[model samples]
Target: MKKLESLPVEELLDQLEVLVDQRDDGKDFLLHSIISIETALLRVIKSDPESDYALSIVKIESDLKEHLVKYGTYLKTEYRKDEISAKSTLKQALRYDQTIPLAHYRLGFIAYKQQAYKSALFHFQHAVEYQRLKPQHKMSLSNQQSYHALLYLSNSALYLAAEAQQQSQKISIHNDVEQTKIDQLTLSPLYKLIDANSSYLAQHAFQITDSEGQRGASWEEYEELIDDATKDALILDMTGREIWVRYGGSAVKLTILNAELLRKLMLNSSETVPLAKTDLSDLFSVQSGDIKIERYVKSISRLREKLRNLKLPLDVIGMVAKPLNGQDTSYYYRSTEILFMLIEYAEGGQ
Candidate 1:
């Protein structure tokens, strides 16, 4: 096949039309090919936003979205029979449009079924967030999806907290450390989860029920149960490579090195001490030298930029300057009282 970028606009439109016809006729068509064509057309529009083809491409994209959603819903209903295909189809639907709550809910359900709680939590959170933004009249099935997503979000958090507690207990036993301290660290994730759940409950009146047809606790009652556990802090799951912000439960994606640096900063933040640039360089195994300090400072700068781009508070990572032996200035990094938790999964959990 010719490269998508090399194809003329007319050829791209022709291919899209053919794929739409095949999809509508119940004939086989590669979803990837359709996606490629759409991406190419989008790139063209991005380069020339005022082009006449933009309107046509927009209409074609609408048709593509409709078809993808219908096909994805069909596959989701059969997910129990062929999970791989269902997941791929739903994921492709998301690739085309990430705002689809139904697709996110289905993916979250699949992750929950496979006991991948972290993954489930991520998708369920998105499902709930997007579903709330959808119009009331358009939410025939999505309202139910939002409800189930909230339930599963809490369930996923519970499972993850239990797992973290187990891991902490094992570590305490092996290392003969203080159980209270370990428990405090391990249970911090629960605090974030509870805060998120409580915030949602406070905003939306969801009539959650038990599997046995029993009425579940109201938001007020649920708040009482977790009153002692609620705290305002970021939750960083190092093993899961995910970070949950306070209140909104938005997940922040960080690069691996940045995440490790954040973990180190959070660990030291308990003592309210700033980590010097030299210490950060040592943590990353950078050689002790002027160049090492420069590289580490740049890394910190990049991390702050990432946080800013994600609309997080820059004070999450604070920078301090001090005199080096009253001659030159040195920089140090400190984090707010953010909580870091490790989430270990079995191989191939996803």
Candidate 2:
């Protein structure tokens, strides 16, 4: 690659423009473009500092920052199977733009996976703080990342506390005085942080009901009502046969039929539209008869009870006897807060 700085000013601007307009064909293309653009931009900025050019240097810099962040995110997410490479690339991107919360979150996740809890805490804290500082528009990527960061932050704190406690216990066997100091210096502070973040998460994560006592809010109200807690409050992992509720820090096991019913409702759910008896029958491959409705009601009741026992909001699954639609009374997931994984099984699993 010829030194972009050696190229005439006009050619440099043209090349930058072309690179900016280039569609993302693949990771290689993105990586190549990011490197080429960054090399040229940095060189020019250093040498010229101030230049009157056809393409504004400010705009080019902004575009380069975006590309750098994008490539960093790709490396962290898509290429995450190679943990070392992902972390390195993300760190390089942070050197260019430190405000990318997604990069920080990914790095934190990698650190957490490696059991480097302290490093994980640093990155996760940064991700949460930066995400909170940004405006959270409804259903935006920022909002999503904000929720993820907070959850990870809380988990990181929990793990750190556990680690500290273990260390304290080891020290207690040697010197009781040192153990007391360690508990005060480390474990207490970590516990406070974990409690504070967890409280914030539970209060804001999901909006259980609308003003009129409706189960879920519309898109317009979703942004205002929901917060970061919604991300992990409830996770249905079909492949693992796990229903994870945030408050308890454990999975709630359900019968296969009940799990299937919950999964069906979740898959077909709409904020404003509820799935009728006919829909449920089609989904469950059962006859649309009284027995089917009775069975569904019992299954939903059991699911709701399990969720209730876990102290999760009851409105996670909403049922209406008479929806606005002319169909039979129906059921739907009240909020879009629940995370459903391995959805492919919804089509094939029993």
Candidate 3:
């Protein structure tokens, strides 16, 4: 076959059609066919020549997003992080709008990875604000994406605040007891927003008038990365943040794939041992060994084991994954005080 670069998009699409139509069994050729089609798409967008190729840019950007969504499970399974090919992906977004909320979100997240909190805050905040303006105009989208965007913005703000609080002089501790009290309250969403934005004031010693950030993170830059959990949660959310990772467990992930089917079954199951697979899938809405679920569970297991060695409460892990029936959804997961502890552990590398 001709290299993707040597052929036109038309040729590639036709080839993709043939592969899709010819496949007999999904397990046998589905992955191969999809991978080939994707590779072709990537090659075409790998670079751009002189001329305004607006069509090319649009196609490539869309392709990148589709790939992310379609293969999120697979990518997540193999890598701890999404590990997107950011250089090319960001270039497309940057070519369009520097202030685009989605663009800002990506940039800010990228910045977060680089430990550039200053830059990350700038990007994340703008992403939230710009996205707030998005409207259906005439018709509503099937999934009003702006809602998720808003949540992400709120979450980012909290994280930014948490980062600042961990630093000195951001907020006067007054005493150890007060600090612990503040930490406890910070677990709530309202406090998280306050703390996250308050970091801006605290960051530069700009006369700390409030407890945390007053304004919040910026959406124009994504350039901050730090490894501090307590603030990461307290600053970003009221209850705390639950990180979903790719823990690489096939059986566990399968349960997640059958989440709905299993949930129905769990409705009738009894007090579980270790946790009935159906019962767990129903509770977490994360069927089997989803990477995110795996990360969460393993993180919890690691926490419990450590507590045992150190002689801390063992039920702490249960506290984190209490599995509230109401909270079972794709948007968020339920957690207890121990979830915060796990986040802290992940941060401290313990």
Candidate 4:
């Protein structure tokens, strides 16, 4: 097999013509030859040649995209080079043709890995929007890939909203204008659109909201990452912004605050140990006697109902009781049937 570049441009073209002739007869051979021709053309273009020698720039750009995306995906899967090669090739593809949706998607995926959610959002939006505008014949992004892009877009917006909510909480801004901005940040229309596509994402969108009254679930059906054993045992995984609970052979993802409340109960699951309403109020950042404790109490009651419905041993989580002296009540969980684990991120890292 002669090196593709060793052949002259005319010779490569002649070979490509022969490959086209054999396309139906020798499909494998034709495919191999097409790849060879594409590689040779890329080499020629990279050589800074005087002319493309009758090669159409549009065709070359289109072919390069397929090659780059395939090779880039391979490199990404291999994980040996850490995606640097794939990223560089995709960047080259973008330089060759700015309108290539795959190139933009690859770049956006890289940004997502780097946790540059804002940049990822921008690139993914462009890739999806531009690809949508192009004719069907020119479409390079598959339906599944487009769906994934939409998911990533929604997740990015959710992350941004979560971050903004966290910031607003830190400052405790009371002004109506600042409050409105915080509300907008927490309730993004983009997330609602994404959530509407699936019930799982809709629950996710609910968790990410700043709504204090949102009902937290132990786990959502979409969270397949948590194993069956965990679900059967009614275990709770607190990682990321959501708390995943497993109960009644069903799983639900709960909000961070709700998970925190459960975590507190789990830590003090011994009968000798109990969490006072005042302590719970402090954990929730509310005054000791504030009416907000009622909400926290309601959340605990919901959690208990979920656990009881699942028939999990609730001995660990005793109950909420009123003190005989008319003082504020305390909650306790003493059963060992339920287990809790703290996860730092989606990968289950510390």
The TM-score leader among the candidates is 2
- How do all models score by TM-score? 0.44, 0.46, 0.33, 0.40
Clashing pairs in 1: none
> Which regions of candidate 2 are displaced past 4 Å?
16-30, 73-82, 136-141, 175-350
Measure candidate 2: CA RMSD. 17.1
User: In candidate 1, what are the lDDT values of residues 62-149, reduced to their tens digit?
Assistant: 5445435433323322123346765776676677678877667777877987999999999888878887776442222334445657
lDDT of the structure predicted as candidate 3: 0.37
Ranking by TM-score: 2, 1, 4, 3
What digit string (tens of lDDT, one per residue) describes model 2 on residues 140-229?
134444565667667787877778687777667764354445555546666777677556544433323222231322333333322334
Candidate 1 stretches greater than 4 Å from native: 30-32, 66-98, 136-141, 174-176, 181-350
lDDT tens digits by residue: candidate 4, 271-313: 4556666556533311122335566567676666555545565
lDDT tens digits, residue span 1-350, model 3: 56666776567657755553343111222433454565555566455454243345554444444333322223322234333534344434444445445555555555655767667667656756665565322111112233333444555556666666555334555564335445544436656565654454234221111123122222222012112322322111111112221111101122212222222222222223123233343222111222244433443344334334423222322231344553322112122232221111111100
Winner by lDDT between candidate 3 and candidate 2: 2
Global Cα RMSD, each model: 21.8, 17.1, 17.4, 24.7
What lDDT score is found at residue 189 in candidate 3? 66
